[model samples]
Target: MKAMKRSTLATLINATLFSAVAGTSFSTLAEEAQAKSNQLEVIQITARKRVENAQEVPVSVSALQGDNLDAYSSAGMDIRFMNAKIPSLSVESSFGRTFPRFYVRGLGNTDFDLNASQPVSLVVDEVVQENPILKGFPVFDIARIEVLRGPQGTLFGRNTPAGLVKFDSVKPSQEFDGYAAVSYGSNSSIDFEGAAGTGLTDKISTRVSVLVQDKPDYIDVKAPGFEKEDSLGGYNEMAARVQFLYEGDDFTGLLNYHVRDLDGRPIAFRANLIEKGSNNINPLYDNDVVYHDAASRSTQEVDTQGLSLKLEWDLKEHTITSISGWESAEIYSRADVDGGYGNDFAPTMGPGFIPFSSETADAIPEHDQYTQELRLSSNFTGDFNYQVGLFLFEEDLTIESYSFDTGTYDEAAGNYGLQNGYAVQEQETSAWALFGSFDYSVSEQLDVTLGLRYSDDEKDFYAKRTDNPTPWNGSPDFLEGRANPSDSHVSWDLSATYKLTDDVNLFGRLANGFRAPSVQGRILFGDVVTVAESETTNSIEFGVKSDVLDGQGRVNATVFYFQMDDQQLTAVGGGSNFNRLINADKTTGYGFELDTEWVLTDELNATFNLSYNKTELEDDTLAVAVCAQCTVTDPTYTIQGPNGPEARAILDGNSLPHAPEWISNATLRYTKELEGGEFFVYTDLSYRSEIDFFLYESIEFKGEALFEAGVRAGYAWNSGDNDYEVSAFVRNLFDEQVVIGGVDFNNNTGMLNEERFVGAEFKVKFF
Candidate 1:
């Protein structure tokens, strides 16, 4: 039985990391160790938005304070557990929890076509979340999370040619702290989170946080008399924030407000590829079907709201700042594709099958977004710095799908009417930017930094087709009219740092980036309306940061090289379903990253992260015309003669779908501060080496090397100054069922992979 359930999940993750280090030495020696030297203070931030010392931020960033998010919530902290401990992050999703796809280094955009546009860009505090369903927004009370990488377009603007992910919360602080946690383990898992604040006077203060999680589905919903069998998916979150601060005199004002709501029901797994074997197939499968129903039951809802304002002045030489923001989001979803019998063979020979009694349902298509930004920054005496920005965005998307035909018998047009007419799109964007950066200190071990940015972009789109209830008129099915394009760009960056001593430092960077050209709703259902150009990149980097030993240990390394032009690839076009966002002709990528942390004593601590990526297609006639059309064609028919040009010449030179050319992540953490509150053990490993889910790579997907290890044990309580802690956690451990994502697009005729899950977790904190 799966090796006795993987030896009972590796003995419950080493007995929950040795009972959370023996309940932290029996609650910090029964509360009397003088709060362990004030919890060994030394956590600082600013991640370059100003304020320094996140290790002197000269770029290459990564921070995850807030008690390391409570020890990664017992080893499961979204974004695929921080992309397995961060090393060039990567995330993939195909409509599960409402689309998620992120990548850095190898860039990103798997083009699941929901209006494709994502080159790594997501900011929270400085607000900028160009709707990708808010990038799966979920992470609470975070006081930091940087991950800057490269090409931040001179300072984050435009689609950020591959870099940027910032989220900072936990503001309003005048004293009164906050913390609250709840957790339950094993299958019926549950988790609750909380936060609070005080200081409602002395210039106002407020903080609120909330998170809720539920677990139950892992597959097996046999219908009939439904009696459960792992039905997979669950998550919910609610948030709120408010703050106001003033310290007049030379002026300093701050105001903020935020709200968020998220609901999720995730579970989508499919893989039976006609019983495995097709060049060693194992897209994850555990089957038992009589008629057919692969499985997928989804629900996602998101609501976000924001407002921010800040102003500061302290002309003691020169200092000024201003930032303003507005944000909005709304999303709704529904998905139910119990594949079994292909939903009864798409109402007998597709072309718009609509059947599936029990009142068919497949919603999913309602999105709205709005954004605004304004910024002004300056700092004169201390080596010049400047910023200027303005941006606006809007979106309105819609999708309405209906299916039915539960085996014959209709009573007056009732089996189904709207097979699929698809329409509803609106996009508008505006931008303006001007940035500056300068730092020069020739002595004291050389220092040089220079930056610049200039951007101007505009886009407009519109589509319509409220409903067309079957009649087959073809041609002019949608997209009445609308398109306005405009673009202008300029990006730059330069850096040089040398301090080979002082614990080491040697940096180098040369950058340039750009991205602008997006119009949603599949250009109003094809027929050439393609306008989506502007993609450029040029980067070269070198880095090294050290603190080896004297500071207990720390190491960082980076190496990069990128060259792209006109590159805006998105394939899948051989008459299967339609999608093609072209512009490839030159491409190249090189990478290497290494991270280290070691305190290997004083109770021991260790950490390591690694990344290696290689991308190509440096022109070979645009990689054989992007691998000859790269499979995907069926925009309502069009194929005749010579097998339609040999299926577009089998999309020549293919390879670029979910671009994964050996990606790696590693983690090894250990902490033992027993005496009352501390004892942690961790292991997170990730490896991805097979990719090409389509884009003419004609179905060739493979995946493996996935591991998750965990352990946590805690207990703490300090009376005299009030503080509390409690813990217990267990995750995956060894319930390894692997396969985090899958695709068989052309092969197996479509859709495949995703399944296997195991759970257990518990946490508590009060301070």
Candidate 2:
């Protein structure tokens, strides 16, 4: 009888998975998961926007809901696939899947400037996706994905001093239902998603979501007179969302709209890609082959849109909230910044050394963002509770850059149209905030939290430089520079939460964060427009949030430290394709993080995360430039460059460019229910260690220690109103290709990672 019901459902799933991990306890999100009975459920988090129960949330959060966010984007991932998947998080980008670039703990801001200014910070649903092409929005119908870490600037404001990433989606509840999925991988890659929700009355409700991914042109390129189409890698992405909900009694409303599109392929970087001074990856690397030669044919395009509105009211014990948002984006990227082909005074060149033939372009054309938030809270549950807020922000940006002239090439044909160079940058930002949070219970096992914020920031910047292929250094330089930086800061956070038993909870936190005053202008190759002055961070944390074995495992650990004043730093591309903005008199970091969850039975469950950070940069009269050919370990000094001298490099303590002092990730899942439904396997792994792709230090730019893995297998059932699944997957499961980011002015270029994705998936649901 079907092999005796698969051996009696694997012996009743190993006796209910270790008797449900010795009698159950676990969970967190699918809307803050709260299951019971079948056990292992009851973990919720909002990291202080209240939804509590993450062992009482004293902040240092970590969350990624259900099926680990559907197996991390299910191949066809983006948002740098959330590099290192949380725990001192990290995500990088050279404009590949749009503009990722996020880092926490070790801070971040590697200036790929499209108005770059980051220290993490990206919130969705609660708005705040301040640029970076609207933070590459795409990650559909999510229900949770926290990762709060450090210095969240009181309730998230400004460019959070290295922290905050929150996304919450899936709302609209009279509950009708939804689901649809598709996946197909390996070079022809395809991924699709769908969602739906309903409720037409009884106070209205609605939801809709969609995503699509595509891949083609399958790599393999060589340009010689470029007829364009060696196909430099490929992608096509689309996104959509629409939501509405209205529930009234005391009142509530929510509306959201979203859109995105991308036609990719612009980060194939790989010229001598390391290995001359070794950072590996260059035995003539090939993942289908590449040689971005005579560039320009490699392109990227993006478009984005957003709109949001949230409202709530209930004045019996106090409750009111409002959020409004609008965002728009346009982006264009064209690469092949010297990853080989024509140079050495061109006629032709090799994949080996293409010393001069960077053809780049970056654009935003125009963009806008606006936000407003207002809040008031305290809805019963005494012992003093409070929350107050007001926030507003605006941004208008425009950035453009172009350069071409792959050096009069004719080595057979590829004649890159001479656009020489062009530049323009404009920024306008205004910000305001006033926030408050308070909670006190004093006894009953202690509880305290205080948060305050008062921010005011402004920026008006300008930079211009039209055409300059070195025509006597100045072709057009209308303005060259301008910045009107303004700042006002007051960030705070104080926390305490001791319940020490009853499933433990012990916490302590002290925080202050800021970042607002930064402007960099790459006037198509320098002309002064660099400013970095506002930076501040002060942090301290301690933690323990347990449930441990007795409750079927769950451990959250923390230990943190921070200090930053000035900080900010960007200084990219030493041989010069410029991006300079520096400020660092001090910068520091210390970390420890661990989040664990285990049910390990009753069909298995496991999650593990680890982090250890250490970021320095103590500035000893800070220096900049460096890398006129690898190997330069600190103390250098030269500076003259407009075409002369320029070696710089002092940066006192170092450590911060892409910071990676060990990070870890793990996941394991197993299930079996046989007869007519359930059978699963899941695997995931991530690791990071070495990193240092700029700001001094060398050995070919640095970036090595790495590991990645992914796997999935499945069978799920419930038919009638439907619910089905069938899967097979693998994503870079040991096809390891490493070498991430490096292009210190060309030769030895770099960038890789993402190849090896085999897939199969099908899902349907309507329950």
Best by TM-score: 2
Q: What lDDT does candidate 1 reach at residue 511?
A: 81
402-458: candidate 1 lDDT, tens digit per residue: 333334435564542223444455656666677666677676877777777788887
lDDT of 1 at 660: 63
The collision pairs in model 2 are 16-602, 17-601, 17-602, 25-40, 26-40, 26-41, 29-32, 29-33, 225-413, 225-414
lDDT of 1: 0.56
The best candidate in terms of lDDT: 2
Question: Cα miss at 29, model 1 (Å)?
Answer: 26
Over the stretch 1-767, how does candidate 2's per-residue lDDT look in tens digits?
A: 01323653454344334322422344222224443334357768777776887778888888888898888876578767778888889898877788899888888888887888897889988898978878888887798888797888878787887788988998978979999898888877788888999988989889999999988867766656553544777878899999989999998899999999888778788777687766777776777676666555568889999898999899989988898999999988887777777778867787766767778788887888999899898977778988889999988998898877765543444554457778888889999999998998999999898998999998988878867755655445454778899989899989998885577677889998899988888778777788899999898887777775555567777777788888888888887767788888888777577777787667888888877787788778998877656787777877676566777878887888888988899999999999888999999999989899887888877888789988898899998888889989898788888878888875767788777788898988895
Query: TM-score for model 2?
Result: 0.35
lDDT of 2 at 685: 92
Clashes of 2: 10
